[model samples]
Target: MSPQPPASAAALRARAETAGLHLPGLILAAEQLAAQVSPGAHGLRRAGPGEDFWQYRPASAGDGMRAIDWRRSARSDQDFVRDREAQTAQTAAIWVSGGQGMAFSGASDRETKAERARLLALALAMLMLRGGERVGLLGQRARSGRLQAERLAEALVAAPAAQADFDAPDAGALRPRQRVVLIADFLARPDWLPGFLAQAAGLGTTGVILQLLDPDEESFPYHGAVLFRSQSGALRHESRDAGALRGAYLARLAERRDWLAAQAGAAGWRYVHASTGDLPADSLTELWQMMGR
Candidate 1:
């Protein structure tokens, strides 16, 4: 197959602007998030096949001469063996939607959903790295170590906004038994989600959906003569009495969540929702526990 063409500079600029792509702030947030989580919070307790030092044991006949920790052995008459922590790192694939809808932030104090998604995505990646897990974007190569999150942030900012549509990830490198986390507003009805998730499960990928919502979207807090604009510039609707639509709007929202949750459950995937006003740490902590299970 021919190689794919690179995205235009204009498209890259648009995605960054819409997503409020701030690398410095994102890095800081990821670091802070890492600090908040207790070390090894992701159920990574076993010691084997890892880089970090675990413990040393007395040398046995089967032990290789090279396995001896000479520095420590010199301190004692008996030979001791060196052992590294056993690595049980799993791959976590993340996708934070850069859709135009994610650009909407209802209040000045609130962060846009896209920015919040990126923060959570990167922060989670940091946590995964600390746990000795491989981290990757949904359609990208997996990586490990402390700096993987930084690289992901750079790639995220460079992606074109037009590529934000809900599409099944290219699973060429996606192996069986890996985890996939999808962060999105999910405002539109995803008729394809059920099949996509089912196929993902068939491929041995467990899924997690983090549905982001704006506070105003959940509450429909507007009253009297409200003009609502589509973030994608696809539609415009004026409400003479926005308050009147609250009941139907909220009902529809609830219905969507219900449907999504049901589909996720059927595919053995986890579903969680959060508002932009909610602290990212809380949601991430919850997600960590879920993924651990």
Candidate 2:
């Protein structure tokens, strides 16, 4: 069989626009998944400087006279200080890989890796927004509120696809003190990742890397004769006994994941592995809990 032709620039743009048409549905799915998990510490309930009253605690020796709430003290025998909820919002930036490789799916029943990544990214942003945290795409300005979530969904769906087989995180976009979430397959062995992590460390930016993969990629369930082509049709491989490759493939995959985990650890960042076939809510819940910490 002849190699497939690459998609024309116009065709790629049209495809991206078509993807935009599903933004509403995608956002709804993400919202539903996010709703499954409670916001927990992500919410603005921590005691700090804020307008909303959080709790009243007994006055301590260090408490200033003016800090005491006389009205609350009058209600109780002991002096009390009114504590307000923390209004400070942390900034979270999310990036979903747009590489053509992400468009691949092992089976018709499973979502494309890109779709799964986008869903998780958007859902995570929604949850963060609910907790009063500012959220945005990695290269965009982080903002808090319902509108920001909508914008994030649009951006995730409408972004142009990467021409390369593997897309690297844009480390140059790192902002100081920003928490980032990068969702990608990481199968291409991104040479730029080490540099990106170094840059993030320099900027004091901490984050988590959620490596999303198709179940087929993880299990290597090929058998007999098989023809493998990348989504971009830029790479091709034919095997008469594909099953013979399983052991080596699995070993390499494990090595890749180990490398990723090590790199993330060196940077004081978290690393998570997820398969597209798994329940998205399960992954979302894990991410939600991790982000809260």
lDDT of 1 at 64: 91
Among these predictions, the greatest lDDT belongs to: 2
RMSD (CA, Å), each prediction: 8.3, 6.1
Tens digits of lDDT, candidate 2, 37-148 = 8874443468887777889999999999999999989987899999987767889898888899999998998899999999999988988888788898988999999998
Off by over 4 Å in 1: 1-21, 39-87, 163-173
| TM-score: model 2 vs. ground truth | 0.82
The per-prediction tally of clashing pairs is 6, 0
Worst 10-residue lDDT window for candidate 2 reads: 39-48
After superposition on all CA atoms, how large is the RMSD of candidate 2? Answer: 6.1
- Clashing pairs in model 2, backbone N/Cα/C closer than 3 A: none
